[model samples]
Target chain A: MNPTTLKLCLMAVLSLVGIGLYGLMICRNLIKMVIVLQILVKAAALGLILAGQMSSQINLGQSLGITVIVADTIVAVVGMALAVQVQRRLGTLDVDALSSLRG
Target chain B: MLEAILFALPILTALLAGIQAIRTRSLIRSALWLAGVSASIAVLFYMLGAHQVAVIELSVGAGLVTVLFVFAIGIAGAEIQPQRPIVPKTLAWVLILVAILLLAGFALPFATTVQHSTEPETTSVFWQQRGLDVIVQVVLIFCGVLGLLGVLAEEKAPLDQPMVDEIAAERERDLRNLEYQSSQSMVSSQQGQTR
Candidate 1:
């Protein structure tokens, strides 16, 4: 595919992911929102990879993107586990209601 | 154009996944849709001739991340009422306008170039000469997963017990309240029997 075409498609993916990210922010639940946020990050990573490919040396972009995926997976899993723990202990996942530091 | 056409199936599937994900009420369904999206996009990467990236997105993006989302949804349960998405409504118009403009102004020219006799030579830059950086990415993914396994092992000990206590307490209160009312009526009925 031509570079311009790739860029356009990549932009579409970015816009979609951005929409999801906005949704993630608006939701009250932590776990589902985090998962949604990850989707946004993944979309960004894909765009970066495709843009990199368009310029040449596709492997470099591919490898860096993979690195990101791996790290992101770890972060996501840890975050999910912590969220689960909090939900189990607190009996709720709504962040607004769970604020103990509020005076 | 031909290459893009070749990927039409997976592209549509991926788009469907995104649409489903954005609209689904259940967290589990949304997570599943993300999985579908990842898989379709992975296929798209393959069509774009990025075999290695496709492999990574398939295993890590499609496989590992989806697993994480599913597990998250599992722990959270399917008891939510998602709100309507206003951002999407605004985005829809913006995206449509941008697409129309890009196609009319830029994409049409690119599309015509699809039939150009000679394809431009792609970058022989850093990718073709990857050196040792590939090892770094593999190690990063492995290390992340390994660390997660350890954390999960430790976290499992207290997994969700605290929240269960709250739910249990609420249930106990409700049950006691019901029992108290039942006894009052029972006593009244017994007095009637005696009379």
Candidate 2:
């Protein structure tokens, strides 16, 4: 595809990312919130890849995105473990249900 | 034309996936949709001459982030559906129109890049100058692994005794009071009998 078309694609993707962020913000669930945060980060990576086509100096967007993926894996595993614990103790995953130690 | 079709397909799929994800009823469904969107974006990256970036996006953004989101969903549990129509339909339409206009204004300027694709890749930043980013990513992954391990080690509650020391102290005080009271009562009874 031509550069101009690719540019448009990137712009549209960014706009979608913006909308996803809005959804994440408005959504009440904590897990949904985490996913939304991930989408936002992915949007930044998209920006990085698009920028690669423009400037000659900033090319690590791919590597950075890869690294983020690896890091995020660890985050997911830990989050899962925490979820299991929360479910065991509290019997429900509702973020609103937790009110024990409010200071 | 084939290239354009290829590029357009991925972008459309990505956009649709993202939109579907955000609009889905459940967190699990939403996460899966987001994964599809990330995969499409990765393909789009490849079309843009950023091969490594595409790989990373697929593996990390698409793969890892999706997994993390699923885990979070499990932890948080399924959320109840929120009531909609809170925002007026007119406001929603207005936002959509404004978004389209704003996007066009921002993107129209970039249309000229299509006329200039033949510029040679002059920079070796990906292979040469990007060492620091790679290193940082490696470190971040390592730390995330360690953090996960730490989270695992920390159980729902630490297995140690709960307030045992305080109980022991209270028990010792009670025993002392009992001993003193018994001794005083015994002495008073003996004195009264002697009198």
Candidate 3:
């Protein structure tokens, strides 16, 4: 990859991270939070690959990216499971309503 | 020129999809948009020469994750009544602006310094050197399955007789009190009619 391409990929990764963080800050829905988290992980995976491309260790980056994907999938699955439970028990998906877990 | 455009296409698509995923009101729609973002990212990965990771991203990120989100939406109800963001809009925008500036500052230095390597053998690196990551990922997947089972498990009624009896008694008492109150109100109304 040329430096220009590398730079563009880096910018995309940064933008994705920013968007993910902004979403995390603003979104109160538990499911939305999970979605934002997935986005953040995607950015990280892309960044890892970009780093690999930069250093010429593309295989290492790909391997790490695969690791990230597996971990991220698990996170998403567990997060959704927790969200379903929260909705069932609390009768609402709003994170604001979960302020006191006293039930 | 052709290479840059090819890279730009997927990057643009990913960014747009990501923004739409955040901006969309419906959870399902947001999930779909996320799928688009993931697909585009996979494309980007393929373009970047990470063929295996790209395939996995397409399957796991775009396919499996989106399916999970839809299933979750089906069970949990799709739309929450829209609420104002926890962060005020002005502050949120300011924060985003600051974040962008910081990211540009951090990322700009690396743009000119990237050096490309000739050998791109992903298979050996994945299988030989990164064995720990693969093992840990397997463990993580198992733990995730266990966690899902734990979270979604049906809550069994307590076997404690005393606690069960106490709860039953409390419910019965509340029912009796409600009945008594209704009866008292009826008698008062009848008495008022006689007057």
lDDT of 1 by residue, B1-195 (tens): 776566556766776777677666777887788788778777766766667767878887778777777766676566665554434666655664665466346423433233223323233433455445556656766766665564355444543677789889999999999999999999999999999
Candidate 1 collision pairs: A56-B123, A88-B163, A89-B162, A89-B163
Q: Tens digit of lDDT per residue, candidate 3, span B23-94?
A: 998999999999999999999999988889999999999998999899888888898678889898789878
lDDT of 1: 0.64
Model 2 regions lying over 4 Å from their true place: A56-58, A67-103, B64-111, B114-128, B150-155, B159-195
DockQ per model, Cα: 0.19, 0.38, 0.58
- Runs of candidate 3 with Cα error greater than 4 angstroms are B116-120, B150-152, B155-195
Q: What is the per-residue lDDT of model 3 for residues A3-93, given as tens digits with 9 covering 90 to 100?
A: 7888888889988988998998889999999999999999999999987877778889999999999999999888888888788767888
Worst 10 residues of 1 chain B by lDDT: B112-121
Arranged by lDDT with the best first, the candidates are 3, 1, 2
Identify the CAPRI category of the predicted complex in candidate 1. incorrect
* Top-scoring candidate (DockQ): 3
Residue A78 lDDT (model 2): 55
1 against 3, candidate with superior TM-score? 3
Ranking by DockQ: 3, 2, 1
Q: Between candidates 2 and 3, name the one with more favorable TM-score.
A: 3
